[model samples]
Target: MAADKVPGMARIAVIGAGMGAMATAARLAVAGHRVVVYERAATYGGAVRRFERDGFAFDTGPGLLPLPAVYRDLFVKTGKQPLEECVELVQVDPSSRHLFADGTQMSLPNASRAGVVAALDEALGAGAGERWGDFLVRAREAWDRTRRPLLEEPLWPNWSVLADREPYPSVPHKKLLRTRRATTLAEVAAWELRDPRLTALLENHALAYGLDPRTAPAGAAVLPYMEHAFGTWYVRGGIGELARAMYERCLARRVEFRFDASVARIAEKNGRAAGVELDDGTVEDADFVVAGVAPGVLDGLVPGTALRGADEVPPQRGASSRLTVLLALRGGRPEEAAHRTVVHTPDREDELSRLFGERPGLPAAPTVTVSRPDDPALVPDAEHEAATLTVTVPSGLPVSESAVERVLGVAERALPGLRDRLLWHEVRTPADIAEATGVDGGAVPAPALAAADGRLLHPSNSTRVPGLFAVGGWAHPGGGLPHSGMSGALVAGLIVEGPEFRGSQ
Candidate 1:
């Protein structure tokens, strides 16, 4: 059915004030819909939160933004001002500095494949660059094959096509007088990359997203390709600035926002979503409802409303959650330091085993990402610096004080004298994530991938109910800054252009 034939202007009730929800609300309002966002919290941005103390600020959610073009398109489609006008986007040069177990360190240039290859060769040895560069070529092929189906379009009826097909064109490797193609990411790393350090670099991409490289499909190669191709970015102040900009854009488009309003249930009438029932005993009627929440949360919102698509929802039992430590240093940040630094764990197998093992525990040597932005906005003065350290741990695992210390120990590799310079530190655990994002177990959702036993696939954006839609990281296209932003575009397209809409051209 065409949008014009569906009905008049719709009264859209969004369940959350997250980036995806706000993005959808802005687009739907631009399409002549009456949009209202009801957020259980007193603020917008969901997990995109910030921490401030004694004039030092730190981003507790995503430290950087990737594929900023997602938001660029959103601003272009909704209003006159582009995203650049709303926020200051700075490309992080030397995309990241990596510290390997062998004490080999290298800083890679932003979005430069050749430069990355050269840096690896210079740091790791001769022939290393060629191997990594060759792997990237195969990765690019996988990206070309799966980009549209996985990121651009909605989850199709025959999603098994994606589930069954391995898009990565893995070169045949001969071992023990047998030839076979790599299926898992670890296999690709060992068979193609061939160096422990190179394998670590390749696997780190998957590990960061909560995927176990040993089991993540070879198609997971797209993760590194997407980042290396698009480059990493930072919003001045913090990533939360992007959220504030998105919320502001929604208000400018006449989208109403109600804070501290919890949705009790989704109202259904005649097999369609009619509106929402608030916990405060109020019923707000709407022609359409958009939900930006986790799958478990959605299940409770509409009791007895069976979810459509997918046989079983992926469990969060072994999913990964982040542990962030915010440090307020009493010294100025060095001018020559890279914006981001990754300290690789010495023992990859042991770390992965601990993280994904039956009884998850902190790795003896955990891989840690340290972010130290030079922007003065994050510090009070030249004498103070704000830094954030992050590590991936099994979701719902009890994080002990020692676990927090272990993360700081790994981070100290990037920041020498970290303890001496620190005035005070704040720890944000999975419990904090659960409270902030309302995702039980605080499991951070990973981006959707083509293969891997369908463990990486998310639910369809369109639900079983006629007028209800899912629009967030937990929905189709999955998580990360770019994916969530795209979810908004996809949901808006399906609602405004009709169910027949495939995706944005």
Candidate 2:
């Protein structure tokens, strides 16, 4: 069907007010549809939540954004003002500072391949940088090959093409005199990077997204490549500012928002989604219904409908979630401190084993990401600072005192005298995430990957039930700020341009 010939101005009922859902609402409204968004929470943004106290604010979701072009595209397509006009976008200068377990420190420059190589060579050794740089070159190849399929385009009907093909052009290595190619991110790190610090650097990329490097497809190399190529960015206030901007954009586009509105189930008519049934039993009807919810929630909303195709149902298991500790510090942030610091876990194997193994427990030294933005907006004044510590832990696992202590201990490496400087701290566990986002076990969705037998792929935007669409981190292209924004664009394209619309050009 052609874009012009598509049906006109149908009411679009969106199930959540998350970034993806808001993106879809803004775009659909721009396309002349009457859009209404129902959010169970009292506010929009979903997991992109902000915590403010005593004039200090903390973004509990993403600390920094990668591939910001996705949201830039959304703002351009939906409104008169650009995204930058709505929210200040600043490129994080040393994209990240890595504190390796062995006391090696490396600060990677944003968006510069050569700079990254130089920094690594200076910090990790001469040839170490060369090896990492070469690996990045190969990772670029993987990114080019899989970028369209895994991200921009809709999941193809014959997705097995993506599942069967490994896009990462792994270099052959002699393992005990036998030639082999790396299949997983872990193998890629070991075979190519060789150095333990380099391996940790590579694996940490996968682990941050809750993917086990041991099992993540080699195509997962794109994760770091993406950050290095596009650069990491921060909104002036916090990442949550992006969500607030999108919410304002949606409102400007005349998209209605219903907070404190829970969708009990999807209302179907003649085998197509007609609307949603609210928890209060109010039947709000629409021509198309878009669900920006987790897979489990979607399944419950439309029971009997095979949302996951026959072969795609993942085993009943809880996905990984994040543990965030927001700290209100008494002292000011140092001028020379990096915006983001990743403290590597002292024992990688043990950490991975405990988190992903049958028996789960907090690692003795779990990797922690500490964010100390220099922005005064996050502090009571120049004399105080707001910091956040994040670690990936198994979903549904209780946050114990030991776990909190471990996180604080690791973060102290970056912020010396952290305990003495801390005025107060608040821990946001998986339970908090579950309560806020409504995802089972508070499992954060990982970005869609190219291989691993479709194990890492999200469900298609279009479902078996006609007129029902899925958007957000839980849908096509999967999670992360960029992926969620892309999912929104894909869903809007599918609705506006019809199925013939392959994807964004």
Candidate 3:
């Protein structure tokens, strides 16, 4: 309930209580404004929402946690304790495992570039480590140069911001793309080193992010930096705990919470966004509104003209699809492996080619990600364990019992004894994802950026509609938990400091 005692103050409405909305509310409240957030789900946190079923907890979306500083920034700026106080982070070394058909298994390190190179040398061969160092230095530079212009800020008309000031007319934008995607990571490794296993192992990451390395941008190499530098982490209880933490913070800030309130339309007046109208005939109004929802959803809700050149916002790239099987196990599995594993066959190159790029159907065998809920809070006790195994498949795969059995057959071939280990399980398909999130065609917001048209990837925070702002996966700092949280804060900062903010009444 808003404090009526605090008289004469402007009320700010943040639509969607996901990471973006929660982050926005925390910052806006600290800026001395009255803020109320309306969420369309049973609880706060949109795609970031989590749920517990029969003692098994699952994050609705976003299973991996990386980049901790973004969260630290959100809390410190809001005059709250850091995330460490909320959740304990454990680094999973040999960050990921890869099994090849030749019966060779390679695990990548959760160490620095140098450390990663050393590990590669030890795992693959001698000189391979040094080449990795050289590659990483280039990757780091690319990340430094583009992090702000491309990922953080909206990248539309403001493309000029990426301009260079000297005799060398800035890194030719094409060069960046050519460098990242010119040769697939697979091809690059094959050329740099003699080990086919290493090349195929390195190249497979393309499919992980829903891109084909051959066609995916070189900017992708930056992905290793965060994972190797900061180390992959898990929320205390489950990935969902992060969402709950952000939700708690929102409550403390006195942000209004409305669940099961689906937004049907964005209210606009005189070419300006006034507020949002919920599906059940309830109208919530505010001076300024920040939408933390997905862009495709926005495309449907807002007036097409409200977003300048909305038509130009490239149509959705069919998102990467996944066949997720959640398991409730009697006891923990082998402790020898890290929290995550990547199992492959000897013919990994062809297999990965099919997985990462255009493939006819699901791979005869799919790469599997096995994660046991290491966070105790997610499970009842040490005797009971919950884990999820995910296999990336082409989007729009059929989700029938027979189709599921076919995939499971492949999983059995890889794990050899996977079926006997399962106590109980649940399977989620791309269709399930689409129905749950309401993103157009259920495409997960893995923005595939190409140098030629990377500008279309992130548009500026200003939605062109006066008094309106956009946040979350569709806005700056693309997808991922940390990025979204930081984006929420950034959006709020823009509104509070920008000319649009209407101070307390």
- lDDT, candidate 3, equals 0.64
TM-scores for all candidates: the values are: 0.98, 0.98, 0.86
Report the C-alpha lDDT of model 2 over 1-505, residue by residue, as the tens digit. Answer: 2222237778889999998999999999999999999999999999899999999999999889899999999999998999989999899988999999889888999999889889999999899889999999999999999899888998888887888889999999886879999999999999899999999999999999999999999999999999988999999999889999999999999999999999999999877788999999999988889999987888899978876667652423457999999999998889999999999998999999988999887899999999989798898799999999999999988998888988999999999999999999999999999999988888899998988987888888888788889999988889999999999999999998888778888
User: TM-score of predicted model 1?
Assistant: 0.98
| Candidate 1 structure quality by residue, lDDT tens digits, 264-321 | 9999887888899999889999888999998888889999878764454343334689
Consecutive 10-residue window with the lowest summed lDDT within model 1: 309-318
Better of 1 and 3 by lDDT: 1
Task: List model 3 lDDT by residue over 1-69, tens digit each.
Answer: 221112235567777877777888888887777888876667765666465777777665667788777
**Deviation from truth (RMSD, Å), model 2:** 1.7
Q: How far does residue 191 in candidate 1 sit from its true spot (Å)?
A: 0.5
List the candidates ranked by lDDT, beginning with the highest.
2, 1, 3
